[model samples]
Target chain A: MTTNHNQIPITYLRPAKGLATLNLKDLWDYRELIYFLTWRDLKVRYKQTVLGFSWVILQPVINMVVFTVLFGQLLKVPTDGIPYPIFSFAALLPWLYFAGSLTRSSTTLVGSANLISKVFFPRMAIPIAGVLSGIVDFVVSLIVLVGMMLFYKIIPTWNLLMLPIFLFLAMLTALGFGLWLSALNVRFRDINHLVPFIIEIWKYATPVIYGATLIPERFRFLLGLNPMTGVVEGFRWAILGSKYVENFDPGPLFIVSITITLVILISGVIFFRNTERTFADII
Target chain B: MTDIAIHVDKLSKKYKLGAMYERQDTLRDFLTSMVRSPFQKRPVSDNQILWALKDISFDIERGSVIGIVGRNGAGKSTLLKVLSRVTDPTSGIGEIRGRVGSLLEVGTGFHPELTGRENIYLNGAILGMKRTEIEKKFDEIVDFSEVAKFIDTPVKRYSSGMYLRLAFAVAAHLEPDILVVDEVLAVGDAEFQRKCLGKMSDVAEQGRTVLFVSHNMSAILRLTTETLVMEKGRIVKRAPSNEAVDFYLSSGFVETGERIWDVDEIPENAAPFSPKALRIINEQGLVVNTIRSTEEMTIEFEYQLDASVTGLRVGFYLMSARGEFIFTTFDTDEPQMYDRFSVREPGLYYSRCKIPADTFNEGRFVVGINASTYRIRRYFQDERAITFNIDPAGAPGMQWPEQRLGPTRPRLNWEIEKK
Candidate 1:
């Protein structure tokens, strides 16, 4: 059967608005590649290691201990009257996944330099696989966090059912910023050296170790300006069943953060797609 | 209507060299520049930006095979990349109707740590093939590449030949409407190259479009129905295969910078001690012209005398461009030797060995010049010294149909016996 090129519906095959000519349908057709790449990243990262799957648990577990000592004992930071270890571990769950995924995904373009220079695929797949692969580690880390809660007799409230929503929001945030930095890293070599420093400063901006309650009541809304502040506090609220402090609700704040993350994710993708055409020549 | 699989409309690519767009003035710089703009107006130098390709256009029918012939850096690969969607053109547009499989480099997209089986699927995905489609053709591709036993092994364990064999096998098996190949035939041995050429010919015969870029003129002439000759990023000639190749070869004049052969660098297989540099020169020692059969030529050799030697034999042999040895002559074999050679004059040995007229035939012949320590173990044999084209005054009487009888137009005395 012959198909008329003119008569075909444009929306069925055209690039979503704002992109010059990125074929989202073609990316969908190659979705299996995305799955395989994500699987390969997960397999290769932990293969033949001494700890094997334990390292996934060990990462956030160790971070939670160090943070509990530093932020709880030495600094005497209040944890909303709960034990400090549980409070820090809950927030560290989503933050660890976001941080780990961000570090790997920001270097995705550089680490896959061989692949990008030689092969032809949707270049988006590299960073996408990187960020998605962290889900496996995030899940493994979540089990340990749940075990810690049981050890402390801290029951997860019904708000735990909303955990997946918060988890997805955190992943989208990592992916949005990861894609922007990876593309920029290819042109400006200095980005490779700046990644660790950026992650260090960003952690302070987000309440990974201390509770979000430490922010003064007046400035609490401004603290949610960093997208991960909502994710960290959202994880604690979902698991610890906590309330927004000082009538400064996280509902509008979380909505604004999600909106901001979505904008970054979409625009980051368009910017990456435009710059991808020049990657092979300049890369 | 006959299907037109590919279309081009005013396609062009421009490249800028040595020009960087400066960052906009920072806040500090903006304050500083506000006081300076009225006093100082600086003109910028126009950095030499070159358009490697300009206003070039062509269309390929659904099943037509086209050959793109050009020298190094003539923008052939850039054109293929643009067509394959590896890069975008600076201006203009190209349209394609079906999936495009491009082999820009053999084994380029293969990952080293992945097994051959995994890479077969990964590379297929990279080239836009579905996993199920690659699975369907998996056994066929493995058998064709002859790497079936090693399919489970990582590609880093495979030899270079094995890697290229499997990579080309995957590219060849990809069932796409158009196949874009860029000089990939040079990856394999001569026999395998012939097989690949035959496979591509069969693919074209099966009503698929092929865009081939190669330096091998004979293969280009044999495989393509239509050919385009490019020089300095412009299509200088477009015609049938034979006429295009003939025009391209003749376009290289003996004088000026229009020579076809790249004589600047030594060839990959050139001689060790023949010359740091050598070229055909006239009696006055200006690099005058290519040798025509009617002219008596001087075979000039410029070499460095590394050590003292009593009998050094310097010579040259004629060969086809394909490295087939035709004939040889040596200075010692002619009983001409400079005895008691010591460090009399070190550095840059210049010897003008004269070639007598009427001793050669017309066609392309490579100069295999060599220098040996009297009778050393053939180790000092320099296989390629230089390659020169030989053209004669008049056309020798010969029938066109017997072209492959031999490479040379030699005059041999013949006799017939009747029983």
Candidate 2:
């Protein structure tokens, strides 16, 4: 029945000629939804918990202790002349955020299946909010890192000013991989089960615990294949004022990470857009 | 008058029944055929494909409330799903010029852990409403839902009735360009059903497009301007609501033996003996489509008694298309030949039961047969005997020539006293 007089063209549902691009206007319209969802996630995460925000400090501190023992005292790994605890904690800050954001954002679809299948929204808001809300924990842990550095009396060099850029890069990486895994997780729940194991393996592969300087100069080019290798070492070098290890160039790694992240983010949007129609049917 | 709000031209949705989950098997079959593998061939089951919506097209003008009525598994839900973009059509296209908001299910986007207040905002967001827009309607929605007292509490603690109430309240206030609802009103209580019907009428009054799917023919007649009858995914008939209901009730019943079923073209060798076929026969034993409620009608059943049975009871069941059982009677309770089937033969047996006129209410009633072996110590049952329908022929003061009430009309005794 022709009922409503005001006819608005819902262009999002219109069939497109090529890849379905993420409608930026729609995202802008749903900005408040993103804020509310992010706020909701933050509140629910700590609302009833005993430790509260202490969990944030506890996560990075515990990982710092474990890594210092496992790679520093246990393996007798070098830390580029900096204290072992400080070295690992510096890298742990961003690596922890990246790992946490990737895992959380990757499962955003499966976690919000009810919302996605029932209502029409910019689906990307969920994963983007997931990755963004993680910044709270990141900032909390960074405070602990700064306090620890003060206790050691080690003043950061001028290079520390670039820390925000490095943190943004880390978010980009997480957003990229988050989109891919989140879409994949909706179809194959195997991705959820595999994320933690992959994150564990990834930590050791990157220069989070052991310094990038420890990887022999000859093998540095091949190791830079992992984009986070440069991110972790850059975070350390920028904060600790350590000279770049032989053949450890941040330029190529940044380029590779940005390119890979862009590809994943774009493709993830396409995959999610195509499969979203069937969500109510199969979810 | 034909300001088409929806122009569905040659619109069809073909669902490959099982192919969605069997794509891998099809790929395997294609690869094996190319390689000429020597592996043992095992035929695949559940490979049969059927179209849910064959090439069917119609136009709906603005400011009309259309009711979609159909039997179970008739693809009414599929049609809504396609229109709402919850699922894609395998073929064909439908063009519509309006913003669509569908209440395919109540509370479609509610989060149980979130409070009622939070969920209102969340649901509004999901429905494509802006925060400012929701804020403007916030009080009205809460007031209409009657859940203002517990608006701050998490929805998980709310009763199902309250949840549906709030959900429907949100959708009702949306005022979208087009609203599509599917059997959601059935979730609430009777009083709420009336309120929801009133709300739908208001929506239609505002000249917005509304598509409603319901089994309650009474509600359809009261509110809808037009109706479409769906069967096996095809729109069998589209007309004014009353005419569609008439055609639907008439075509639903099939005769077999002393009982009836609500199906046309009964499958052969379908049921195992005992009331195998039924037909509505007159005093002359001639089958007729229409029957007078006051006339003598015989229900004939072609059945088989495999074993030497004692206390054999046969019953006739009358039901509505919605499967509401109207009434029932058994053969063993009848006079004269009550115990006559003692030495029944192994082959087909014919049992004719008679019904008196004006005893049944006026409405569509499906006929069903039930039989059981009645031994003193134990009993074996043959329950799903058969089924059919009874049409109304004689009732005065009722809207004559059809297009008035729901599927049925029953005559009950009423008395008045004057002092």
Candidate 3:
């Protein structure tokens, strides 16, 4: 936008001599492409399906209902003070957003092989677009969480203002792992099946179905190692308020999770940039 | 400002070939190969490393259109890929000034699920156009594609021709400082192909640099100022369009008696049928270019059918210098051979036939080849493939000969007794 010239010059391309070259300027120039790709993805997501955008709301609601019947009713998992459905839905919302985006982002490179081999663009745009497209589903599913809260007639405290921070943290956690999975998937497609398995296992470890205290106090920190663990708990605490979640504080877990998330996210980006040059050749 | 729009220097790309490492594309293949690698020993020479491009360099002045002509696997696509940055070079570097739009294939990212209107915007963005730019040209693109009536429909339902029309239309409207186009014209029907060629020529006339790669020599002759001929991973000659086309066509046919097919030149579709070599042997059993008109000659066609092919037939077409068809003969034309080999099993086979003395009339003759099954499929056919010079000065009728006009000069015996 700031350029005086009509056309941008495409400079030399060669084998990297030292560190991986990240064409931040090209990415910036093509930022609109990312938006369009994300927009295209959002539109195509719901096309031709009878359910359409309802699937966005339906996915979390269906899983939450299943969890409530199994964990909240059949076994009667202790839920501190708040109702089980609201508690479960709050956690499930962020968990699904994180899981869905991660799964989609991991395969984005291989999925867009046609684009990668033919046109010149910032390769990072593809997975980033994939991760960004999940925002629509995230916002849509958030409405269901609010409806559940009204159904339970629960009034939130001032801690509700902190929900945005938890949402940002969940996005960070999702994008961090999404970057890693998507790049790895380009080479070792075994990562494709592995991503779903990890997400499935990660859901249980993150306390999405049951409350956070379900983990024994000694091993609770171990759960925080999975970044989504702190995110899910942070969501529950922010939505249900501090008093509702007993026997645990989400503050320390959030710190640990955020640190791990940033570490993974940075390394994921580095690895992706490193392996991107070989994608067209190998894929 | 420098006038050079593109400069590639000492560029090279090496590819390792082997079944084991030939693009272990799938993770399953990688895992299985990993599991099997330590057990079986692989010879060091088993994997042949080929340099797709070798220290090649070229430059294009601004506002000039250049064509690259090459045999398949001669590194034309590799050079384009390197220029497009789809894959990194092994060693050298290439500098491209100004905005470079590359169409490696038509419709790089057109999702079939998206409607035509949405796909245009998506494809424009994929080619690095901004929203405002695409919006400015949106109507022009729609009109040029001539699919405005069906613009709202998903492209998957459109006939393939319509799909290509929309795809090529988007590419044509992409206004870049430099354009790189490959064999995208091969996809569209003839009329659409002409439309694409016209659009490319229009772009060229706008004083933008263009790099075109195609097998259509007529298109090259009409559009390009200069052409680069590549052979064996190197640019052998760069000249004006006519000279380069002449060099490409005539250089490989100088050796008349035998023609050897390189492993890389054989097409993949010619799968079960691979032609290895073809030669003509004189009466003395030596392969030679010139043959006496009265001497018997043998035409030998050597090829391999790796897999059993039912109804496999090998044939040759003999033609005159001006492409006049003299005769077409097939190996299976013999009545007795009908049941002798119904299905060709996996093996190397040679089809050779002897021509009696004085079978050819004079000058030079050409031999074309056809390898296929009757009414089933045609694997490979090359018309006017190779030519050989024939000498008739020493024939039986040489004393009274001026010029004979026919495919064969048969020397028939006549009694001089009064009848």
Encode model 3's per-residue lDDT on B203-267: one tens digit a residue.
Answer: 99998999999766677888898999987679999999889977876665756699878776675
Listed in order, the DockQ scores are 0.16, 0.18, 0.53
Which candidate wins on lDDT?
Answer: 3
lDDT assessment of candidate 3? 0.81
Badly placed stretches (over 4 Å) of model 2 are A1-7, A10-29, A156-158, A242-249, A274-283, B19-47, B252-362, B366-419
Of the two candidates 1 and 3, the one with more favorable lDDT, higher being better, is 3
User: Which of the numbered candidates is closest to the native, going by highest TM-score?
Assistant: 3
TM of chain B, each? 0.67, 0.63, 0.66
| Residue-wise C-alpha lDDT for candidate 1, range A100-205, written one tens digit per residue | 8888788877777666655567888888888899998888787887787788877767888988999999999999999898887766566678888888999999
Residue pairs clashing in model 3 are A106-A182
Arrange candidates by lDDT, highest first: which order? Answer: 3, 1, 2
Docking class of 2: incorrect
Can you write out model 2's per-residue Cα lDDT over B1-419, one digit (the tens) per residue?
A: 56766766555565443434333333345567657856746444544555667665777886788999876557776777677766666666677767777874787778777889988887877777778889999999999899999999989889888988899888888877788888876556777887888888999999889999876667778889799998877899999988997787666434433433332222212233334466777656778645666567787766665556656666666666444556667776755556565544566667667876555555445665556544222122222233344455565444657554554454667789899
Candidate 3 chain A least-lDDT 10 residues: A1-10
Cα interface RMSD of each candidate: 6.0, 4.4, 2.3
